[model samples]
Target chain A: MNENRKHDSNAQDRTDRDWDLLYEIRQRVIQSVAKNMDLFGVTPSVGRLYGTMYFHGQPMTLDEMRDELGMSKTSMSTGVRSLQEIHMVYQTWKKGVRKDLYQAEEDWYKTFIELFTTKWRKAIEINSKEVSNAKGLLEHLWQNTHDENLKRIVAEDLEKLQHASEYYDWLSRLVESFETGEIFKFIPKKSEA
Target chain B: MNENRKHDSNAQDRTDRDWDLLYEIRQRVIQSVAKNMDLFGVTPSVGRLYGTMYFHGQPMTLDEMRDELGMSKTSMSTGVRSLQEIHMVYQTWKKGVRKDLYQAEEDWYKTFIELFTTKWRKAIEINSKEVSNAKGLLEHLWQNTHDENLKRIVAEDLEKLQHASEYYDWLSRLVESFETGEIFKFIPKKSEA
Candidate 1:
C-alpha cells in the first residue's frame, strides 16, 4: 500500500470531491424534509436531526449525531425518542459496538402509514366509545320519557349520533387500509413504469 | 292559545328538560371532536370554538358563537376564519339576516378529505420538484466525471432519488384518491347496513 502512496492520494482527492457533491445534493433534500415535518407533529429542529441522520445513509451513535448536526446531546436523544415512539427510527445492534446505534426507517410510505394510522386509530377508538356511550344515554332517555317533547328531542339526537357513528366507521376502515397496506393496491408504492 | 295556560306551562317545563338532555349529549360529542382537532393543526381553544358552532346546529353569527362559547369575539372570528380556509366551516347568507352567518361543514369525511388531501398534495409537489432538480444535477455530475469512484457515488445517489420519486408518485395518487373520492369506494362514507 505504501508503494502506491502517490497514486492513492490522487484517488483520495477525487473520492473526497465525489462525496462532497453527494452531500450537497442530499443537503437540500434534508432541508425540504425538515421544513415539512410539522405534518408529523414534530418540531423542525427534531425533523432536521432525523433528516440529517437519514441522509447520512448509515447508523450513527448519539454522540456522532450530535456532532454531525451540532445539536445538544439531550435534544438529539429527545428527538430520537420521539422518532422511535412513532416507529420512524430504531436502534440497531452493531457488531461489537458498545454505543447504541440508530437508523432511520427509510421507507417514507411505511413511516406515513405507521404514524398517521396509529394517531387516527387511537382518536377513533376513544371518540367512538364516547360517542357510543352518548348514544346509549340518549336511547335510554327516549325510552323513559312519556312526554312527546322529550321523545322528539331524543329521536333527533339519535339521528345525529347515527350519522357520527357512520363517519367513525369509515375512518376506522381508512386506518385499516393503511395499516394493512391495502391502500397500496389502489395507490402502488412503486412506479408502474 | 292563552286559554290552555296551565297545560302549556307544564309542557314548557318538560320541553326544557328535553332540551337540556339534548344539549348534554351534543356537548360530549363536541368535546370529543374538539380534543381530536389537534390533528387538524389548530389549538384546542380554536377547535372548541368550531365544535361549539358545529353542535349549535345552525348558522351562527360571530356574536352568537362568542356568546355560546364564552370566547372573545376576536378568537371566534379567528377560529372561524381558520376553519373556513380549511373548508371545515363556511359563510352562508341567511335571507333577511343582516349579520354574516357561519356554518360547520357537517360531513366529517369531506372535511378530512379536503384538509388532508390539500396538505399532502402541496407537500408532494414541492418535495418531488426539489428531488427532480437534485437528480438532474447529479446526472450532470455523472456525465462530466471520468473518475470511476465519482461515477459509482452518483449512480448510488440516483438510485436513492429513484426510490424517493416512486414514493412521491404514490403519495400524489393518495391525495388524488381523497380529492376524487376514490377512497370512498374502498371505505364507504355510509355503513353497508
Candidate 2:
C-alpha cells in the first residue's frame, strides 16, 4: 500500500512539472506578442488570443481557451469574433462539443498582407492625396521662387512623385499575390487539412 | 459702403472654406491612420502622431503639433514620447523654440527596418523555444506512432522549421537594407535644408 502511494505521488509530481513548463511558455509568448502588437496598434487581448492559439499546438474550444487564459466567456466570445473578422483566426465545429473551436491562421505572412492591403490600403490612398497636394505646393514654390536652386529641387520632387507611384503599384500586386495563396506553395507546410 | 460690406463677407467666406478643407484633411488622415494602427496592434494615438508628423511637410514643434492636431497637451506629450521610443520620431531643437520640436526621421524606411527587425527578432526568439518544445512532442509521437506516414509528417515539420529559420534570416537582411538608405537615394526630395 505504501509503495503504491509513493508511485502515485511521483506521477503527480511529473504532471505538475509539465504543467509548469507549459504555463511558462504560454506567458512568455503572450508577453512578447502583446508588446509587438501594441506597437503595431493591435490590442493586447488580440495578441494574447492569437499567441494562445499558436502555442496551444492545436485548435481549442472556447471553454478550453477560457480556462487556459483565465478569461471570462464574454471577453473570449468578443475577441474570437474580432479575430475572425480580420481573418487572423478561424472557427471549426467539433464532433462532441456544441461550442466552436478557434485556431490562428497558420500563414503569418499572408495574414500580414491581408491586414496591410485592407486596413493600410486606406492610409496609402490618403498618402497618394497628400503627395498630390505636396506637388501643388511644389508647383507654387517653383513659380514663385526666384532662387534657381530651389526651383530645380521642386522640379526634382515633382518627378520623384511620378515615379514613386510605381512602387505603391508594385506593393499592391505583392499583396494581391499573398491574398490569393500563391506564396503558400513556397512555404512547404506539414499538411493542409 | 454696401459694396465694402459684401467684399468683407466674401473674404470671410473664402477663409472659412480653406479652414474647412484643412479640417477635413486633418480628420481623414487621423481616422485612416488610427484604423491602420489598430489593425497592426499599436495604439490609435501612435498612428495619429506619426501621420500628422508625416503630413506636416516639415518637422514641427510640440506646441505647433498640439495646435495643428487640436489635441490636448498631455496627449501630444505622451504620443511624441512613445514615437521617439520606437525610433519612428525624433526630437530636435529649433532656432527659436526653447522646447524640443519633433520630426519623423528623414529616412522613413529605415525606421520601418528597425521596427520590423525588432519585432521579427522577438518572434524568432520565442519561436525558437517553441521549436524545442515541439521537438519533444515530435519525439513522443515518434515513440508512440506505428504509422509511418504520421512519423514522416512530423519529420517534415521538423525539417520545415530548419528551413524556416533560413527564411527568417533572409527577411532580416531584407529589412536591414531599409536602414542603409539605398532606397531613399533612389527617390529625390525637393530640399533637405
Candidate 3:
C-alpha cells in the first residue's frame, strides 16, 4: 500500500510540474505574438484571438475562447468579429449554447487571398481606373503634340498603364477561382460525407 | 503677317486645350487613387500626395506638389508629414525652395521590401518567437507523455510548427534580400523595372 501511495504521489508531482511548464511556455508565445501584431497595426486582441483559434484546431465558444486566451468577453467578441470581417475567421452555431463558436479558416493562403480581393484588390481596381482616365487625358493632349520626344514619353506611359490594368484583370480572374473549395486541396478533407 | 497671326493664335489655343485636359485627367486620377487609399484606411490627402509623387517620376517641393496636384498648402503639409512618418515619403532640401521637397521612393519592389521588413516582419518575428515557445512546450509534453497515441498527435503538431517556422524564416530572408535590389535582378526583370 505504501509503495502504491508513493507511486501515485510521484505521478501527481510530475503532472503538476508539466502543467506549470506548459502554461509558462504558452504565455511567452502569446506575449511575443501580441507584440508583433501591434507592430503591424493590428490590435493585440486580434493576434491573440487568431493565435488561440489556430492553436485549438477546433471550434471554441466565446466563453471557452475567453478562458483559453485570458481575454475579456468584450475583447474576444470585438476581435473575433473583425477577424470574421477579414474572412480569416468563421462562426458556427453549436447545438446547445446560445453563444456562437468560432474557428480560424484553416487555409492560410485562401484567408489572405480573400482579404486581398475584398480589401487590397479594391484599391488596385481603383488605381487601374485612375490610370485609364489619366491615359485618356494624355491621349487627348497627344493628338495636338508635334514634339517627337514628348509624344514618345506619353506613348510609353500609356503602354505601362495598359500593362498594369491587364495584369490586375488576370489576377482578379485567378483569385476568383479560389473562392470555392475546388482549387485548393490544401484544406484537410471533410470527415462527414 | 496674316500667316503669323493664324499660327500664333492656333498655338495658344492648342496650349490652352492641352492644359485644361491635363488638369482634368490629373484630378480624376488623383481622386480615384485617393478613394482607393481611403478604402484601405489611408487619408485622401495622404493618398493624393503619394499618388502625385508616384506619377510625377521625380520629387517636388510642397509648393510644386500643391500646384501639380492642385492641393492647398495646409493639405500638402499635413499629407507630407503623415507620409514621412510611414517612410513612404522622403524630404530633401531644394536649392531654390525655402522648405523641403518630398519624393516617393521609385523602386516599387524596394519600397515594398522596406515596408514589409519594417512593419510586417516585426509581426513575423514575434510569431516566430511564439512558435519557438510552443515548440519548447511540445518537447516538454512529449517527454512527459506515457500515452503513445496522445504523444503522436502532439508530435504531429510540433512538426507543423517546425514547418511554419521554416516558412516564416524563408519569407523574412526573401524580404531582407529585396532591400538590396539584387533579388529583383535574380528574377526575370519585370518590364516596369
Q: Rate the local accuracy (lDDT) of all candidates.
A: 0.84, 0.62, 0.67
| Candidate 1 lDDT, A86-121, residue by residue in tens | 988989997899999999888888898988998899
lDDT by residue for model 3 over A127-157, one digit each (tens)? 7777877777788667867656556656765
In the range B1-193, model 3's lDDT, one tens digit per residue, is 6999999989878766655665566667767866665533468777877877866756788888888767698888888887777677888775777777788755443444566556656667778877987998789798876656556756766776776676566546545655565444544234343
TM-score of each: 0.88, 0.63, 0.67
Q: Report the lDDT of model 3 for residue B10.
A: 92
**Which pairs of residues collide in candidate 3?**
none
Candidate with best DockQ: 1
Question: Model 2: per-residue lDDT, tens digit, A1-193?
Answer: 6999998888767656554544554466456655555534468887888777865657888888788779998888888888888888898776887778888776655566677567656656765666566556666656765556545655765665554444445444444545675534533233333
Residue A170 alpha-carbon offset, candidate 2, angstroms: 5.4
lDDT of model 2 at position B135? 56
Q: Model 2 clash pairs?
A: A37-B41, A40-B40, A40-B41, A40-B42, A41-B41, A41-B42, A42-B41, A42-B42
Candidate 2 interface RMSD (Å) = 8.5
TM-score winner, 1 or 2: 1
The superposed Cα distance between candidate 2 and the true structure at residue A68, in angstroms, equals 2.7
Error of 2 at A24 (Å): 4.7
Calculate the i-RMS of every candidate, to one decimal place.
2.7, 8.5, 7.1
